[model samples]
Target: MAKISLRPLDDRVVVQPQEAEEMTAGGIVLPDAAREKPLRGTIVAVGPGKMLDSGNRGELTVAVGDTVIYGRYGGSDIEVDGKEMKILRESDILAKVL
Candidate 1:
């Protein structure tokens, strides 16, 4: 696949979601209908942080390549070079994966 050139605007981030596991830990294979949409992803691209009312931009805690977990139904899905990606606000991010 070609490199992605898309960059997000202020406070927005472009995430590359992790693929869902086809099989459970118990070795049960799940069908497509039984699989849940992944809420975890790596931060591929990030915006220049949110603009504050004080006229300064707030710093973003997460950087590129950071694996983060977000809300179950957050973000907008986008396709780049045939790869699925998500774009969402920093607020949508729930936790950083260790």
Candidate 2:
């Protein structure tokens, strides 16, 4: 894989969408229309931590290259360098994907 990466501006982070989880029930393969949309993604790039007014660092809990599960209603969808991605503040991240 190419190691190309972009730094997110300000307090934003970049995430690449992950494939949907497998469905195993009655030995049936689900159709695309029947599958739930994936709400988790792989971290690709991240910005420097959000800065503080006091000239101190506001640490971001997540870093680049982590798998994360995010809220479906959060984030602004985007395409960075022709790859689909989400741009959101670190606070918008819900949890790390196990």
Candidate 3:
């Protein structure tokens, strides 16, 4: 696949979600119907911080290449180069994966 060149705008982020585990540690293979949406992903792109009413932009806590966890229903699903991705607001991010 080609490198994604998308740039988010205004506190938004482009995330590439991790694929769901197909098997458990106990060797149980899960079917597609049993899989859930992944809440974790790596940040592929970041937008500038949110614009403040005072004309200053708020700082963004997350940076590019950071792995993040978000709300289950938070982001908008999108596809780029036939690969699934999510676009979410910075506020939607729950935690950074160190």
Candidate 2 residue runs with Cα over 4 Å from true position: 1-5, 21-24
Q: Residue by residue across 1-98, what tens digits does model 2's lDDT show?
A: 23436778767788887876566577677778877767888878788877789997677778778888888877888776677788777878889966
Q: Give candidate 1's TM-score.
A: 0.92
- Top lDDT model: 3
Superposed model 1: Cα runs more than 4 Å off: none
Top-down TM-score ranking: 3, 1, 2
RMSD of 2: 2.3
Please give each candidate's TM-score.
0.92, 0.77, 0.93
Minimum summed lDDT over a 10-residue window in model 3 is located at: 1-10
lDDT of 3 by residue, 11-98 (tens): 9999999999899889999999998889999998889889999999998999888999999999899999889999999999999997
lDDT of each: 0.91, 0.77, 0.92
For lDDT, candidate 1 versus 2, the one ahead is: 1
Q: Higher TM-score: candidate 1 or 3?
A: 3
Highest-scoring model, TM-score: 3
Model 2 lDDT-worst window of ten: 1-10
